[model samples]
Target: MNARQGAATSVHVASPPEFHAVTGRSFAAGTPTKSSQKSDDRLTTARLWQVRADPA
Candidate 1:
């Protein structure tokens, strides 16, 4: 590690144990969801995902 490195350009990840925090708030509506195939494939066929908020 050098002292002249760009330390301010790095992103910080702050997450606690037993839970993970993400920078996105959208849902995918294309796949059947995880079940037990042991496969790693994430593909969504939507342009936008809406998040409904309470009107109260």
Candidate 2:
């Protein structure tokens, strides 16, 4: 699906910091499956709310 389609299907789920951290770690570990890659692709292309680190 394209970015617009992905954005349309995406939900607004509030995740904790740990959730994002673990997901980042998992991707960093490079053991993602095809499904995981698809998920990652959706996330990257969709217009989703993300947790941004404080630039303090």
Q: Pick the candidate with the highest lDDT.
A: 2
Where in model 2 is the C-alpha error above 4 Å? 11-56
Off by over 4 Å in 1: 1-19, 29-56
Model 2: how far is 28 from its true place, Å?
26
| Candidate 2 TM-score over all chains jointly | 0.17
Q: Weakest 10 consecutive residues, lDDT, candidate 2?
A: 9-18
Candidate 1 per-residue C-alpha lDDT over 1-52 given as tens digits, one digit per residue, 9 for 90 to 100: 4543433212212233322444332223321234433222233212122222
TM-score per candidate, chains pooled: 0.13, 0.17
lDDT per residue for candidate 2 within 1-56, as digits (tens), equals 67755553222222334344333323222233234665578676463434344333
